[model samples]
Target: MYDSFRRDGVWPEFDRVDRQLLRAAKVDVAQVAAQIPPDLMATDGPRGVPPRGHDRMRLTVAGIACCEGGREDLDLFFHALRWMAQHEARHYPEPGKTSVKVTRAMLAKALRIPARDAVRLRRLSVLLRDERWGSVGSWRSTDDQDWSVNVGRDVRYFRRVRSTDDFIAATTAWLEPVTVATPAADLPGAASPQSPAEHGSYVDERVFDLVRQSDGARWDCTKLLALLRELDDNYRAGNAYAAHALLRAVMDHIPPLFGETTFAPVANNHPWGKTDGRYMKRLVHFRDQADDVMHRQISRTPCVLTMEDMPARAAVNRFLLGCVSKLA
Candidate 1:
């Protein structure tokens, strides 16, 4: 029976031992018989359907019995358990002694039908714990709940099984690191250095660090990095026109720190006037070059911006880092 559930093989004999094990786990025998079809449980009968649609079905006698005496919502408790079973069947195929541990994030990933929210996942976990369906653990009060079960040994007997350790490792690999979002009002000054090179290096380090620590902040930082690298590569390869166009694209997308204020005033105005003003002027020049390259009526030129435009690139990098730093 264990092997059958773990591997989806033929049904096992529903013998006295199996019944005793279910009884020990506080599972209601009558409920199990009613929820699981007789054909599916029979060893000599024709092949029966899988338990995939059990989620849609109303709580069966077995399901209610499995809920250790707690008043947990039958629908959610069953749904969480079904998700755990499905994950075990698909990811951890080998039979093992250790039970499977499940987390809210794991449930969210598995049941992607409509995408469950954090609140729903939390509620489900609470219900499962209250019902004695599974045990919950956390290192600290503020930490997220972690759930584990001895599927066929602890709360209930099941045909399917998997290792708890393997499940944790797999889930950790799949889930993204959680991060807090930051608002635009918290953004710092876009230009903060005297030397363009120093400013560029500072921005690069901050943006890279943020990318490594945050999942939500990754997209924009990654895009900025890709464009910057391409711009640098094209400039070095003497594809000056391509580099100029990429720089413009980077500037357009790097979420401005100054809200709706135009880039022109920010470049020529105070606060940025010291060193950033000079670089901004160069960036404006490159923008014009990009415009000319895109809209020239005749004599379309190539490789207009050269290594001499490195300062403009530095300026843009600083601006991008300033914007990205606002992300928590």
Candidate 2:
């Protein structure tokens, strides 16, 4: 994001101001600044709060609704997901990073449940009421102002969901690792996930299934390749996570169960033929070698060359892009 203040010819670069003029400016500056509302200030203040202090601190239902913009359940899941994601981001100690985009299907497979159930479970736990202490440390004594208003009493709150243990378990496991371990440097892929037995289709939260999964059949490789030319997109990692809601699935529809040419390390190999359109062959070969550690050949895989078991940083964004850009 472009900072409003970071534009050209803005603030002075030097800090060599004389003390006398600085003192006079401070008082005048205070008076001038006070004319604006406290919300304009960047951080939590003597009498106000900023959005960046802690997880779930500055979040509002309005902000969540605007950003995620899905069914009540997916909206809630996204709200919770973004909150937890932002919290994890703060302790990351780096600017840009790559994190795996494990699908609900993959998660369901690990958790041993149905995919529909996995998605339902994910949608159910939209609000972590117990986890939220207070908004901005100001206690809202009234239930109307409480953040958990929609948690227990809402009717459309994934009506039949008892407890989202499976979804919670899957995500909890997926996110617990700072880095993955393997026999041969483990190339930092996704964690050992939990799953379900059956796979269920997804519901379009915004338009009552107007955008169905079956819609993917409308485009072939030629059409999808043409679509990519009309658009190019990028999403920043972890901070806002807003862009993910709009663009994540656009790519998801194009990629298969586990094949993305841009992300699966087909081009970055020794004499690997590119025109073959067989990235899955390379992935299966490398992933299989890594899984079978008899010869320690997993380390030789191009994708895991300098990373951990899954190459989280090296491949995630490309995978996301490939999902958006169908093979063409």
Candidate 3:
């Protein structure tokens, strides 16, 4: 049986006994069927069994047993079956009764194996078929053709039985791991406000931290970070208009605690405090330019923000960071 399995390179179809066992264990047969390789399964019409060649089958009955129960359970199952195969006369002991009625204690004694936990042994027992004499016993005795027919029928039933809701339920249970948020301080290859290498650039890592620390009711820091990340991407892609719009969005989303309704108030309240009015004046001018472009307002000259205006962008980022600091 082991040699045939190794040579065939495809897992043999589960027999009546296997299906009954799986059902008794409350295993999701459909889920198990879904995992089976497409080519391994039998299809209808002229294409009988597909030639497997030399490719080794990946799954085994032992693997299925492991999925349903743990490794110890599989070991118990294999050991019990081996015992049954070895000691036929001890249990049956009669010619008329072809079926072996081997109890757990009898099987354990035959193999000289240690007694297993009752619950686990009960689950393993399902693998043994219960029926009239010759018709029931070890899977080894079952005809391959019979096993294939049973397997094919069950696969079809599972495919047909499963609904859209079943799929949704399975997917919901099999959820992807939640991603842990990365600290902006740990972000590499990017210039942050605290970094000395680029003092003039506007990348405030603290903004991310502030947003994360804030109570969700007060601010949607996640949305803020997403916008900031997109703004950075747009700037790198040379979409200055989009970058400016994203900056305007950032300004708009500032928490009410900052006491700033518009970009002017934040920019004017800079520590330089109107002493350097150029930053505030340039910010207002850029805001108006972005608004005009977005609203499709006609201008005498084509008023567009571009990469050349990065200095003003950096200054605005500094002012925004100042607003974020108030929340801290």
Candidate 4:
């Protein structure tokens, strides 16, 4: 969308958000530049977001020619991704669809190479360069929902990592690519060819400990409370909750949201003659009636809450009392 004040007056950034997405696709900039058609680059209409850095490939090759890659190969590169996306869209339409991977895997196996390399292995790789690829714009923490998606994986380096700003750095790296061609020295590491024993050793006791932590109920009850608290904070911060997600995300080396584990009940209950308001027996999740024994934190702005929230707060202090009693 283009805007007089915006970068493109007719082609505003968010207007074509999916077009800006770069997950997995032609990683080489020079090759990408050679592959894309001017029509694809032109600000026209709704465009499909391709997997594995497809956004970068789209940008690099959209309207330009490059030093590398013949036009035929470039065309093939675009077609290959189209074919992959078509196969995926037709067969699988939701998150974590296996059809795309399965199709790519079958093709890769027929030719004999790893899956990621299959991207670089295509004839189009010859044309793509490093500089052609870049991130759309700012980083969002919510992108973690698609962390395992093909595009998500390709853009993982751009998401929150060791540094919350890692995504920007990584995107910048791709944007300023010297070449898509890997330096021979970094090739071995980049290729990700792990031998059996080396790979096994990589998953040492530390890894096991981490894996155990996800499903582990072996910790002191106090730690369990800590975990619950963390989940509470996450929900408060606009994240959905499932015990599994909480454990899995926390245990993972890189979690989207970290450093919060405070659990508090959002409802209240009492046993006595009816007081100020209606006395409900069961736990109502987020309803808070200050008029009654039950109190509710007024639903504040900047928070997405459900209408079905229970007003009852957890018996946290009571539970702690139980824990202390057990200790005594």
Candidate 3 global lDDT = 0.47
Q: Write the per-residue lDDT of candidate 1 for residues 100-142, one digit (tens) a residue.
A: 5555556666655234344455545443543333332431124
The lDDT, on a scale of 0 to 1, for candidate 2 is 0.31
Score residue 47 of candidate 1 by CA lDDT. Answer: 35
In terms of lDDT, the poorest run of 10 residues in model 1 is: 152-161
lDDT tens readout by residue for model 2, 208-265: 1122222355444443333332222212122112222222323334444235433234
List the candidates' TM-scores in order: 0.32, 0.21, 0.34, 0.18
| Pairs of residues clashing in candidate 3 | none
Q: Among these predicted structures, which one has the highest lDDT?
A: 3
Ranking of all predicted structures according to lDDT, beginning with the best and ending with the worst: 3, 1, 4, 2
The whole-model C-alpha lDDT of candidate 1 against the native structure comes to 0.46
Q: Give the distance in Å from residue 142's predicted Cα in candidate 3 to where it truly belongs.
A: 67
lDDT of 3 by residue, 1-328 (tens): 2223333423344343245547789664445545656433322212334323332223333333324333454455445543443344223344665454445566556556555444444444433332111224344323322220011111111121133233234334335464564555688865443333232224444444445556365555677778877776666566656766887677677635557676677666656455346665676677666675477767687764455555465476556556566655
Per-residue lDDT for 302 in model 4? 47
Q: Model 1: runs farther than 4 Å from truth?
A: 1-222, 255-257, 265-270, 300-313
**Full candidate order by TM-score, most accurate first:** 3, 1, 2, 4
